[model samples]
Each structure stands twice: as structure tokens, then as C-alpha cells.
Target chain A: MKDNKPEWYARMKRGPFEVTKFDSEMMRKVEERALIDRIKPRKKRFSPWAAAVATAIVLIGVYFLVPKSSLSYPDTQEVGAGKSEMTAEYVREHLKIGMAQEDVKNIFGNAAEGQSVKRDFAQPHQDDPNDMRTWTAVDIWRYDYGVGEGYSVHSDLEKDNGFDMPGIENGNIESQLVIVWKDNKVERAFYKYMSSKGLESTQIGPAIEDFPDTEPPISDEAKHDSEYPSLEVRAIGESTLGKFELRPRKGSAEKIQPLGAPSCLGLDTDLTITGDYELFFKATAGGESLIQNYEALEIIQKENKAIMMQKFDFPKVELYLFIPRYTDCHGLEFYAYGIDKKTGEASAFTFQEGDNAIPYWTTSPMVLPTQLDDQLVVEGGRFAGTDGATRYRFQPDLNKHQMMLEGKEQIP
Target chain B: MLTRDYLKYVSDIPTATLQELMEEHGQEVWNYAYFLTKNVDMSDDIAQDVFLRAFLHIASFRGQSTVRTWLFSITRNTAINYRKNAFFRKVTLLEWIHSASSASSAEEQYMSRTFTDTIWQLVLKLPPKYREVLVLDAKYELPLSEIASLLRVSSGTVKSRLHRARSKMKEFMKEVERREG
Candidate 1:
């Protein structure tokens, strides 16, 4: 209303501006979103062996990103002093690029996000120094993990059509682990951890006289917001996760592919799911014909066992509730596997996952097809060793994908 | 205040500035989205999304564009994307059918207020680029340079698009008038 708008535009001002009551919803979403952003890992929580490996390998006058011909052998670790049962020497001689994404996941865990990237590795043409030549059209999988994407303040930008502003002077900081994959193999790894500090004291960038008189805000907000806020726990696939809803579960079971079962057996082999398996045959909700994965409309339970089945006619969805049968060292991990009865394909209700700590999403909890009642859809669930149970409502079309979160706090 | 203040507020504490942002520009964004989407719910959703994204990316708010311009640009893209989504199309179709099938005379009259007039129809009929430029130019009264920045196009492109949009609108009105007479 202050800046001079067009006069005829006043006629177009379709007013009677009755604001809708979406404040609570917006607030809750904003709070959860902020919470999720905060939960991304700022510092690398590396296993001692991996950390030692990275440190040692990065030193050896290195071939960090090269598709290597050989490997480095680390010296050794004091016996009974580390969690990685594998000897540091074994790890050193073995690891290299041309490793499967799954193999990487076994070591580094599942990536937070994967993006296909094309980087032109350009060189000056040998014949013509002026001519630019691209050697390879490299297609890479850029996997980002726990990281803080620090921002730069572009002040006096009007002065520069060219981006000549001193970026380091603006005090920008970022921490990220980018694993690039080419031909389904790890091609390169880039790790950067930057922090904003006084040029006189810090060793990262240039000195104090380097910057202009116009300095950035003094608050350590960039540092603070860059890490987890509360819940002190990584989010469950709280948002986007795994080969999400893209490929249908039921296209003829081609081959038994173990999706990141973590080959605790060996580096090359995978931990396959073979022992306890359950397949169901059911009549459709309409009771017309047969369906493969649907339940026969009943709550099935067995004592002492954590897994159970509940047929909540809320959208006629069949969910197999179970906990991963891992050593009960940590808190029990629970998952609700949704069954596409038609395909008899059951998918773990996990959409995406971050480092073992961060929460992600499964699928949007849905209301029944016909009834449309006020029942909250179970977006995803989590069980922490410390915090007790709390129901997260499916906040659909709210965040990146539909996510379930526990609290509803109003953001300012 | 200016975009600098917004940048400061954002960098200070990202989540703490949503109240100020919503209070300042929520309605204009909603109205802009509403005109583009032609669906009340879709408009509301897009407006909420624009604010949500702005809140999330508050750290990246470089003060390159005015807050209003930035927000409107987001609203613009969000509206276009929502329109493009297959799920959105399906949902919109379902809503149209549901409302059409069930609406009474009074309900239809109330719904009529949603861009039912001839001029509004003509505006909506324009292609997305022209429609966007015209609305931002004539409705929001954004400067050509700002519009150029928002649309990621040159000022010349924005001008030509606006000119084309106005010419098309005039043509629609004249044709309608001739037919009516």
C-alpha cells in the first residue's frame, strides 16, 4: 500500500480480505521444518577407524579423488580399543573408488539425498591453448550428509553486476560430506568444514584487513542454527527418504536385492532377509476378489512378540508393525510396513533416512477412502531409547513430503 | 523496513521472523496465488508454501531483491508448480466435479466471486508468462527491473510480455462487446 501501485489496479484489489484460520497449521509446520533443518549433522561423527583412515589417507601425499591403482595400508590400532572390529590395516588396503553405493552405505550409512550432477572436467586444448576442451561428461551421484549450508550476506550487491564481493569477508561457513558416484561407483569424496571466526585468531581464511568496513552481524546465529535445536536426536526419515514411492513394489519380484541390510558378514556380501517371513492372502475390502498383501480384517496379536497387525478400517490400509530384530543393545527400532495387497509387496514404512540419528518419513498417513473421518493419519513413528511414546500426526502437503511430527509449537 | 532488516532478522533466528513476514505480506501473496490458481484452497496452500520456503531459506536471503519481490516470485513459482502437478490437477478436477455436482443456487453465487467476471477470465486466458507479467505489473505494480529480476528475464522481455498481455486483453474485450452488441 505504501509504494505507488497502479490506479486501475485498485479496482482489481479483490478485497473483503477474510483471513483463513491456518495460523496453527502454519506454525506447527514451520516449527517442525525448523526442527528438521536443525537436526542435520553439523560435525562429522566418524568411527575411530574411519577417522584414522581419512586422516592417514589424506596425508600420504594423496590420490584422494583418483580412481586408484592400489591402496594405503594403515599401521595398526591397540587391541580392544576400538568399536570397528576390522583392523585399520585391513580397511586401508581394501577401500577404494569403483565401490558399489551399497558398499559405501555399509561403511558411511545411507546418504541423506542423492542428486545427479554433471561436471565438465575442462582442459585447454593441447593444439590450441585458447580452445576449451572437455575430457569427460561425468555423471555423478552427489550424496550430501550431515552438513550446515552456511549463507553469505551479499551487501552492496548493487555495486557489482559481477560477483566480486569478498565471500570470506562476509563470514560464511559450511560443513558437508559430498560423495560423488559415477557408473554406480564412488568416484570422488569432498569434505569441507568451515567456521566463522576473527581473521586475527582463525587460520581458515584471510586476515582482518582483508574485509571492508561494512562487517556482517556479530551473532553466532549461523553457528547456532547450523546444528540441532532440541530433541537432541536425529530425525527419523522425518521427511524425504529412500527409493520413495517411485517404483511400485509389485513388478514381478525380479531378483532378491537387499537394500542396505549392512553386510555385517563381510564387505562384499550383504545381510539378506531370509529367516522369518510372512506373506498374506486376503479378500479385498470390497470383498469382491482376492488380494495378496491385504489382511483378513482383524487385529492379530501374539504375546511377547513386538510385531502385531491391526486392521484399522481407516482407508482399509494393512500395516505390519514390527521391530528390527537387532541385538537389544540400543532402544528397539520399530517400523510399520505397508502392504500393497495387490502386489503382495511389503515396503518398510521408511521413505528416507539420515545418519542413524536423523528422523525421516515413510508415507503419508491416510484417512479412509469413503468415510473421511477426523482420524489422524500416522505419517511415521519413532522410538527413542529415552523419550517415551508420542503420536505424530500426518502433516500432508506440509513439508517436502508428508511427515509426522510430535509437537505443535507456534513459531514467532 | 527494507530487505536488509529482513536479512538481519532471518540470520539472527530463522524461525522467529515468520510472524512479521506473514503479517506483512501473507495476504498479497495469497491473492496473487488465488488469481493464478483460481482455486481458494490451492491459493492458500501456495501462499503458505511460499512463506514456509522463505522461512526455511532465511539464511540464504541475500537481500539481492526486496522481500516483497522475493516472496512474490516464490509465490509465482509455487503457483505455477502447483498447477503443473499431476496430483494437483486430479484434486482440482475432483473438487470441481464435487462442487459442481453438489452446489445449490446460493452456493454457486458465492463461488461466482472467484474471478467470474469477463476481464478476469481474459486475464486468466493469457499464457502463463504473459499472465504472470501482467499481474505483477498491473496488479502488484512492480517495476520492470524488479519484475525482470523476479522472472529471471530481461526488462525487454518483461515489457514485451506485458504489452502482449494487454493487447490480448483488449482484443478479448472488443470481441466480447461486438458479439454482445
Candidate 2:
């Protein structure tokens, strides 16, 4: 106790429970609440939904009251200037694939220049290098909805907090509508809904509403050449588990050693395990189960439960895993999506417990693949409190390029 | 800080100033709430509410205590209120610490966990009163007078609570070591 008084107090004084990195969304929320309070009559509190409704009614009135001539796009017009119905449903219903720029503008007013991302999908002219007009280029525009609702990333706050995702700057983006214009005609169009909670169930399809009940109207392009490959993880039967070898190749498991101290390259990496819980992953692509031992600590699932686990810059692992942490009676529950970097598409693998799809949960001292095996075996299930080590394997859909845990079978 | 200049000003705090305040003391407020209510979701809500309340009612903040302590005071109150509310589900302290199992023995997990994690886990296991006082003294390193004022207790009571908390932690840790051996 005496020895602990000095050294222990020093470590405790360092504030281990203290959150080193504050969540920007929480900060924005706090500010938003305060702003609302300041604007309202003193000491009166209104529910956020009520305020939203009231504001909507007023905005709707203004939209209808505005002159028809003013509704027309004036080249420099913005989304809110005339078009208030630039919602996901509106875009899905009204917008078409091959609409001209002028026609699209007349419908949805204009993209808010400040809150949109524009890039010329082009290169230099082959013939006249100096002449900028000669080059053939497609204009791609990304108009993000709910930007003002603390949806978009403030780069300064992100940098100050040491969290950075270059291409995926919209890590916390709620909704986005992207339009690609080629030769003055809309070549491609898609509406994406990215849930900050990392719920793969929320994403139906391009032009689908958030948390839609009906199936997504999957475009012809989506059916054949999907931007993101699928990832499925399921509990394999006893027969598959018996024959499965995580590293089937000779000496392949030992070829790659576990990372020395669970290190990562991301600026705001939450790779700390709760204690000595070491979680390793069997990285499989195209049905070849490759082993990579990644010892991840409990990255305390905070306000924004869905966080970019790791920004894999490595050539082999070019996917971002967004795991939303949930703890049921079993222990810590999580479902992760392996997002493709190039296509900005995501592949998800989740485990089912009862009615819930809880991809993986660590029982007490959490670990994945408990041992090196050909199949991805997660150690924990409903009987975890007593039986312990209820192994579930990742059922790989090779054709779909997905690994999912559909059901769990007890291994004796 | 915004504590010194804006102490007497009875106006709604500017968003920038409020953000600056959050940046400075947000973690402590959050950690304090987490310590009080071992629920992450509740802590998030409590911390956000604490800052919002502070920003909205800057007029109530007198220049008596540091801004951090004031925020802590608000956080304690907010967390207490959350518990008292009918809708709030209290996650018991025991829930945070996983009971030793034959499959994944406590010894095995304890061996891998950092001493800091073990210590914190043990601290969380203590009774609410004891844990509160001990965390204030050890984690936050608040003066006895400040802690007593914040908890609305006398200095002697604070001292007694801290002593008991430390004793309990020492005993729990020793038991851990004995089991490991």
C-alpha cells in the first residue's frame, strides 16, 4: 500500500478515466442545444422534434409563398434559395439518369456550392495541351444533405482532435446525393445514406430512404457491377469447422507474426484493449482465408458508436472497418463493415443472436479466432456464462465475396 | 478561460466561448459523469447536458470556484438526476467487472490487463460514496476542501471516505494477487 501510494497516485493523477480525445459530434450537439436555447425566449425549453416541426412548417410556407419566377435557377442559386425539397425521396422520385444539367437545375434548384464537393473527372488535352477548353472532362458533383445538422466534418476540428480520413472525410456524413455529368448530360446518379451508427441495415441502395421498409430499387448497374463487394460472416456447421484450417498453406500462420504492441497508423486510432484481451483476425479475400493477428483492445464505444476502426493504407488491406460497439448480457457486442477504399462502397459481416444481428462480442476477456484455424471461429454465444467458448465460424459466400455469421453451433 | 472574465456577466454565452469551455473541461466532466454513472450512453447525455446547462445559465455561475469544478458540480447533479428519473436504467458496478469464469479465467485476463486498468476496475467496484470521494482525491487530485464542497460534505467526512476507499482498493488488489499466485 505504501509503495502504491507514490507510484499509484502518480498514474491515477494522470487521469486514465479522462477522455483524451473529445467527440466533435457531441461538441456540435452541445453547441446546437445552446444555440437553440439562446434563440428561444428565455428559460423555455422545447423538444428538438417540436422545434424541427415548427421550423419545417415555416420553411414550407416560405417555399410555397415564393414567386414562381424566383424558383427558377439563376446559375448562382443555392439549394435553400429555392429548392427545399431536395430530400432523398424527392431525388429518387423526380430525378432521372440522363437529365440535362439545365433540366436538373430547374428541378432541384442548384447545389449549394459551399457544402458540395466538385471534381473534374478528366485529364489534359492530348492535342492542345495549353488549351484548357479542348480537354474532355466529366463534372462530378456531390451534394451532401443535412450538412448544417452536424453531419459534415469540420476539417479544423478533425485536425485539432487528431482524427483524419483523407478520401473519406465524410466519416460522419448522414446523407449524400452524387451526380456525374458527361457531355452536358447526367451520366450517373446515386443517393447514399451513411449512418453514423455504422448500421449496415440502414443502407438499402442508392436512392433508397434511410431505414426503408421496402426493398431498394437496385439499378441495373448495381446488380451486375456493384461498387462494393459483399462481406458475409456466419456460423458454419460442425462439418466445415472440423475440416477448416485458417491457414491451410504450410507454415503460413507463423509466416506473419502478431503486430508488436497493437500499433496503427491512423491519427485518432482507438486500438487499446481493455486489459490483456487480444483479438486476431483471419483476413480472407475471394474465399482464401489468410491469417493476420490483430490484438485490438476495447476502443470504448463513445457517443459516435460507429467509428472508423482503422484507415488501412496497406495494399493488402485496403478496407476500413466501422464497428459499432454494443454490449448485451454476453459482454461487448459489435458488427463491422469492411469498406472498400477505391469504390467508397462497404461490405458488412454480422453475427446473429436471437432476433439481433450482433456480428461479434467479446466474452469478458475478448478475443477473436481464439486459436489459429482455417475458419474464422469467434468464442462466445448465449451459453457463454456457463458453457464458454461457443465457437461460430464465418460462412463465406465466395461468389458474393462476403463472410457472414448466420447461426452458431456448439463445438464439443 | 472563460471563467474569470465571464463570471459576473449574466448573458447567454457566445457559441465560440462555450465551445472553448467544452474543449478545456469536457473530458473531466465526461469522465466524472462516467465515474458516477457507469453507463457510456448516460455519460454522453449527462456531459452534453452539463455543458448545455452551463452555457445557458452562465448567470448562475459565481466566481467562487474554478470553471472545471463548477462543471464537475453540474455533472454530478445531472448524473444524480438521471438516476432518479424513472426512465434511466442503472447499470450496476458489478456489471462492469466480468466475474471469473472457468473458460477465460480472471487470472489469465488480469495477467494481460495493464495495472492501470485493473486499478480502475477495482476502484469502480467500490461503493458509490467511497468511489466518488476516492476518484476526486486520486484521479482528479482535488483538494480536500474542494471535494468536500463539491460533494456537500465536511472535510472530516471526505477524509474518512477516502481512507476507507483506499483500504478497500488495497484489499481487493491483494486478493487479486493471491488468486494469481
Candidate 3:
């Protein structure tokens, strides 16, 4: 908590460098260069082989290999000599633009070293509904190759900071492969490795064109139910939208497709609340009723409105959790429901609140749900007069059909 | 900041907007490049390239951060790319020796001509990460969150680096005082 700024910083603000100022002359040169680059024809897309050869020539003797066009390739060790197994060549050859997470795991012989999913929603234009924010969930997977054991200033600083620090490295740097997945498909991939002088990164394929953050065109079939003020539930159809209850004054609820869910659902789980006050959850996968006509009684009982739904997985189970946007209670809270994907049996996750075992909820500070081992933990605190955070763990029964609160720990 | 509403949802930046941006942040960007590379000539090229890249890739600007933060991120990336380029590194290695000598003479010249502070010289001598967070926080007065975003590290990391940077600067200043004494 050393929050005070040193007095020397005030003196440093004057800036000691006497460099080329961004004057009219420099601006004119930059403008000219930009104009020339815009008018110049882009270089032809380099084939995998050509790109490798070009890289090898440019970086002489500094570890480069030809990317194989086919997925069938030798093991990591067989691919290169005297360099990290996950070379830029090996990554570019194996990782395709649209490969799935499982496909990546298959190629790399294991899951990624680190992975995370983030939902990025752009601010929507109020005037145009078409300009509304679309769901763009970016799932990133990182694979590191090579191993180094030594104490160095660069690596030590990097370790002190989080693992997200890329590019900076000492001699014991790992050849890193990063894959950005969108909608369960590889959207972008890059490989990074250290040369003698510094770190070098290579984008695997053609530069990905940035898709404007606008609502995608709904299909003709999906367009039919695009109308509001109606409830459409399908138990055995290909895909269906869930219509939920909404408070009369809050206007028509916006249809928000939930965040990253398993691909096993095979359909976008759309939650639409309209004129009808019926709340139901419908999910169909492979022409099977993953969750059929499951009434959200707990959600309906609580007057709080559910804004979005998120699905997280266990060993062999997937649970869909609905998040209430606005809670009238002193603290933020949400309700979660779990349905065994294989057995189609449903369960509700509830925690003890005083005398009553109420549906799962947290207080002022909302801690999102995360799976630890075989348990689902939801944490919240500072509700009403509560001081510290409360941690609740939900341990599913042996059948995995029900989840009960195992215990609550008061976090300081 | 530019008085004119320079940023609009557009595929490319208008010449007027570009001029306004350069007028507003050009010197800061140039100085930042110098901080990274420690070479004035390379800083010149890098500053130009940053604006040029910004002009060409205006469509990619999502307005997640302010124009200044975006420009600084670009500057850092451009400097990193330059550092990685073997040809530029060789040229910079030679420039490093020349700049070192020129910097010492510049220090002497500034001492006689005007009041000179050796703190920035010590800042330039610090490692890249610490130097960047320190300069960005102290000079630009950017929020820790923005520095974290620009550096692609956590806010905690930025705070730690800042603390360590100031400590190192204090040590360097003490050393200078000892030598002078």
C-alpha cells in the first residue's frame, strides 16, 4: 500500500528526450508512406512451404521448418532438431483456422497449457436495432514448448507478473502457440519463439478480417420465431427458443444468446421473455431431449429477472446456469439449474439462507460460479448486514442427478 | 485533446483528424518510441510508422480505450517489431554507442545551458518493463488500468513495477550523489 508518488516524478514530467517531434515535416512523411502503402498491391499469400523457406532464408540458421499441408505429421520431436518441438513451422502446419478444441488437443497430444473464455460485447447503437451488440465469445488456448530451468531477471519479472506477459523472455524461453477460438472454431492462431536477439511471432495463416460487431443475419427457420410476444417450446425439434416471464413495466425482454456452452447442445440457447408470463427451459440435442419442458419454478418464484444464461461443464456433465440481471435484494444473486445431459434428469442447486434452504444466491459482491474438482462453488456476501463473503459448495449425488449444498465457509 | 470531434465510426481517418491527432499526441508518441529504443533516429521512424499504421488500420480501432492509450499500444508494438528485426537491431547497436556518447554530451550541454535533471537519464537506464510503467504513470499520468491494458499485464503488476521502478531510481540517484560527492 505504498501509494505515494515520488517527488522525482514531477521533475520527470518535463521529458528529457530531444527527439524528432511529430511536426509538419514528420507528419507529411508519414502521410506519404501511408498513401504509398494503401495504393501498393498486397503481397500474394505465401503457401506454407514458401512461407517456411522465406522465414528460413530471412532468419538464417535460427530454427525454421516447412509446415506440412496435411494434418498427418510426425511427432513433435521428429519435426525439428535443436529447437523447441512446437516450432512456428509445426504450429502453422497442424493448427488450422477452423479446428475445434478437441481437434487441437488431438494434434498436440494434450489439452492446452492454459485456456480461458471471454465474452466481448460492443456498445450498440440505440437507433438501429440491427446495430445491437452481438455475442462474440473469444476462447483462447495457449501451448508452450521447450523447458528452461534457471534464475534470470527477465523470467523472474515475468513470473512475478501474471502469465499473460508475452514477447519478453530470457534464454530459457518456451516456444509459445496461441490459438483464438470463436464459436468453438479457431478464429486466429499465432506462434512465438525466441531468436538470439529477441522474440519473434508469426501469424499462422492469412490475416483474419475483423467482423463488425453487429447482429448476424438470422436464418429463415430462426426468423419464423423472431416475432415477440409469443412462446415457442420444442421438445424434440432441432433447436428451440425459451420464452420466460417478465415484469409488466420492464418493456419486452431482449433475446440474449447465452455465453460459451458445450457444442453438444448443437443449437444456440436463445432466451426470449415476451408478453406471455410462462417460463420454461427447452434444449434438444441430436434429436434427443437434453432438457425437456423443465419449468423454472425457482426462477419464477423469485421476482428477479434473468438476463442471460451460461453453461459450465463437469467431468461428463453440462449444467446450464441462468443469471438474474437485476436483483431487488440488497445483494446481487442468481439461480442455477443442473440437468444431466445424458440421463435428462434435472436438479436445482440451493443454499441455506437462515431458516430456509433457498435457491442459490449471493450478496453484494457476486462471485461467479467455478468448478473445483467435482463440486460447483458459488460465493457471495455483504447482503443486508452480512460482513464477510460466504462460499457455498454444491456436491452432486452419486447419480449426478441432484446437487446439495455441502457446506458454507465464511471468507474474510 | 483535439477540440474537433476527430474520432467517428469510419473505415479510415480524415486528414483533418489525422493532423489533429498528430498535433495532440505526436510529441508524446515520439518520446515514447525514444524511451523504448533509446535512439532518436529510430524514434523518428517509429513515430511516423505508428501514425501511418494508425491511419491505415483505423477500422480496427474499437474505441475500447482512449486515442492516446491506443496510440501508445501501437508505439510499443512498433518498437517491439523494430527491436526484433535483425537489420534494425544491428543498426541500433551501432546507434546505441553513438547515442550513449551523445547523451553524455547532451547532459553536459544541458547542465551549462539550463537546469538539468538526471532522473530521466536513470529512467532510460532501467529495464524496459519498469521504465515503461514508470514513465507512463509519472509522465503521462495514465490510470493504472490503462497502463495495464497498454502493457497487457495486470494492474497489480503495473503497481509493482512502478514501486520497483521508483525504488531503483532512488538507488540510482543515491549512486549519482555519492559519485558527485
Q: Which 10-residue span in candidate 1 chain B carries the lowest summed lDDT?
A: B103-112
Backbone clashes for every candidate come to 19, 20, 0
- In candidate 2, what are the lDDT values of residues B65-157, reduced to their tens digit? 777777887888777555543224212323333432444345335432533455777776786788998888888878887887787644544
Could you give candidate 3's per-residue lDDT for residues B1-181 as a string of tens digits? 5532335376677677777788888999988997888765677778987887788777667666677777887888777666654335555555555545465545335433332456776887787777888889898999877776677544544665676588678767877887797
Cα error, candidate 3, residue A306 (Å): 45
Over A1-412, each residue of candidate 2 has an lDDT whose tens digit, in order, gives 1113435665566554433534888899898867766776573345767765774685577579987655543333343232233444356445655556766666555663321222353642132211112324435555544443333343211121111122123444444455655566665454544335321111112222111111122222223223222112211111111111111123211111111121111112221112112122332332333222222222332221223342223222132233323232333444433433343333444444443444344432244333223244566634323444566655433334344565566655
Cα-based lDDT at residue A53, candidate 3: 82
lDDT scores in order: 0.41, 0.48, 0.55
Model 2: residues with Cα > 4 Å off, grouped in runs: A1-7, A17-21, A44-412, B1-5, B90-117
Query: Candidate 3 on A1-412: residue-level lDDT in tens?
Result: 3478887778987856544356889988777766666676543458878876874574353323434333323344432223355665466555777656666764774535545533443542122111111223334666545544442212111121112334236544466566666678776665666765355555543232222112112222234335433223311111122222223222332222221121211112333222212334343432222232222111211111334455666765556555543332334555555655565444455554333355546544345678788787877644322346777787655363455677779886
State TM-scores per candidate. Answer: 0.36, 0.36, 0.38
TM-score of chain B in each prediction: 0.76, 0.82, 0.85
> Could you report the DockQ of all the candidates, in the order they appear?
0.05, 0.12, 0.14
Worst window of 10 by summed lDDT in candidate 2 chain A: A234-243
Off by over 4 Å in 3: A18-20, A37-412, B3-8, B95-116
Model 3 pairs in collision:
none
Model 1 scores a TM of 0.36
